[model samples]
Target: MSGSPLSALSWRKSSLSGPRDVCCVEIAFTGAATAVRDSKNPDSDALFFDERVWNRFLLAAKTGEFGPN
Candidate 1:
């Protein structure tokens, strides 16, 4: 969150993206925090979070803390 907004940041798509063009969240690891944005719109808005918070988020996602599909 320390850097400028998504309008100013450089965004890129993932190389491992799926054949169906699976919608993924683009990320910029700025060392102190992680910035995420919609893959479809590289120049759009993004959500930024502290590295610790981001790690916790990934853990919860992996553990299905958001409830079953």
Candidate 2:
């Protein structure tokens, strides 16, 4: 993922973000992986996750596994 060109991917930010918002994460979906990068630093390396791991992480997030206890 790091070697490939991220500019080719269709990165998208959350719709909830306003025009003035600067702090947010952008995501791009690929055939084999999902890409995540900071909207404020688009040139930085993106985090890539395969389908299974990404889905698991999403489930955990939805279940508040990352929330404070």
Candidate 1 ranges beyond 4 A from true positions: 1-16
Give me candidate 2's TM-score against the actual structure.
Answer: 0.80
lDDT of 2 by residue, 1-69 (tens): 445689899999989776865778899998889999998888899999999999999999889999974
Per-residue lDDT tens digits for candidate 1, residues 1-69, read 345465565665678787665677788777677899887666566788997899999999889999995
Tally clashes: model 2: 0
TM-scores, all candidates, are: 0.66, 0.80
What lDDT would candidate 2 get against the real structure? 0.88
Model 1, C-alpha of 4: deviation from truth (Å): 7.8
Report the CA-based lDDT of candidate 1 relative to the real structure.
0.76
Alpha-carbon RMSD of each model: 4.5, 3.4
lDDT of 2 at 36: 96
Off by over 4 Å in 2: 1-4
